[model samples]
Target: MYVLEILWIVLFRFAPLPRIWAVCLIAINLGALFFLDTTYGLVALLAALTGIAVMMVIYSRLGFVRLLGIGHVFWIPMLIWFAASLPDRQTDPALYWWVVVLIGFNTVSLVIDAADVVRYLRGERAPHYRWRAT
Candidate 1:
């Protein structure tokens, strides 16, 4: 559990990797059913994917990254869903660890991503975005 959280923090924080690549890896490796076997796991993965998909859709339509409340509008429901399903302490330690890993990773990543959006909205900086070839 400790190792998984540590790895999550490291991968999302310090790794010299693009955010999209990291998101893709997370969405597949952890978000996929094979890596998650608990009720909470399934819910979190589904919620995360849904939130991300919505964000992507908005980004595509709006052509800007800093829409007010957009980040919260997308993620708050998922956070609530995760909080509602927390397991009891007597649950298996292994499953508990998996939950922590997924929750911690998702929470930290969302916070970082939100900060970037806020900064963009504030005009402190421009949002980083990938250019698509037309």
Candidate 2:
């Protein structure tokens, strides 16, 4: 399940799809959070909000490269937290699946963002498409 979610995000990122489709995907992903355990779901939501806050701060103050670096840095501990929570799979399969899906998305996004940061550092001017672009 987690593997499929990761593949979906990676494929969607590169596919020539309309922006609305990406928005739909995000909506679906967020909607799925309701099925998760309350505590776990709230934690995930907070983490996401924190990530957004961090991105806005970094992007507004330091620019894109710094935003990417800070975002990836923030994700590292979240990744670790998800990994540490893997044992919950035995006790609560549903919550476990939710965490796995979140981990997959975060990991893929981090990788893509890291690649872009490296490209920028290397002086590459290749255009990158973001899902949120207008």
Candidate 3:
């Protein structure tokens, strides 16, 4: 699909920094899934999957930096739930650390997305990259 091609180019070609960041984020999400049945792991994985679904929809209609907030908006409340239920959630050291990293990493990403959305609303509407069929 053109959206996939465009997303690939947007992340890999036009934006090397974002590419590296995306890889790291993917690693974190996948790493967190190692304990899928424990300590909020299922919810975390769901959030990641849901975020991906939302991101794909947003990407279909807008550029990466523009409406990126919509892709990440669900994460904040999930983080809050993670924090509120931390002590009660059954977690070992590994799962605990994964949750911590997931919270920290996604919080930073949400902040970045918020800023990007603002920039977009301020007229930075041009897409960073576009893919054309060869």
Candidate 4:
């Protein structure tokens, strides 16, 4: 999971292939959710929808900068939930390692996202591609 997440992040950050990376990540996440227990999957889906709605409202009112500021707040509870759901380390070593990898991925994402928010708050414009100099 860590490797996969890192690959996705790298693709998004430096590969200049945002749409492909986004689609691949979305597909992978959906596949994972599909394999989860029905109740948990449904709850996660709902939470995702709620987060999108909240982000949309924030973007509409405060614009992209503020939205990025608080957009990743959901990760805190998600990390906790993932930790709490982890299987016993001794009895299920593979599952334990997988959960740890997921935690690491989320931690990295949280740090990066927070740094982006801080940069925005400090008046740095978000980076983007340019076809030619203005």
* Model 2: per-residue Cα lDDT over 12-112, one tens digit each: 65455634444543553474468555655666566665665665565544433423434445656766876876636787787677668767766776776
Clashing pairs in 4: none
Rank order (by lDDT, best first): 3, 2, 1, 4
> What would the per-residue lDDT of candidate 3 be over residues 31-58, giving only the tens digit for each residue?
8568777757777777877877887776
Off by over 4 Å in 1: 1-32, 35-37, 62-77, 80-85, 88-90, 124-127, 132-134
User: Candidate order by TM-score, highest to lowest?
Assistant: 3, 2, 1, 4
TM-score per candidate, in order? 0.56, 0.57, 0.80, 0.55
Candidate 1 local lDDT, 30-104, one digit each (tens)? 643643666666665666556556555655565434542253344456556656665565756655555556566
Q: How many residue pairs clash in each candidate at the backbone level? A: 0, 0, 0, 0
lDDT of each: 0.54, 0.57, 0.73, 0.53
Q: Give the winner by lDDT.
A: 3
Q: Compare candidates 2 and 4 on lDDT and give the better one.
A: 2
lDDT of 4 by residue, 32-123 (tens): 36536543345445545555566556554554343343654665786688677866789756545655665665466567678877776787
Pairs of colliding residues, candidate 1: none
Mark the 10 consecutive residues where model 4 has the least summed lDDT: 125-134
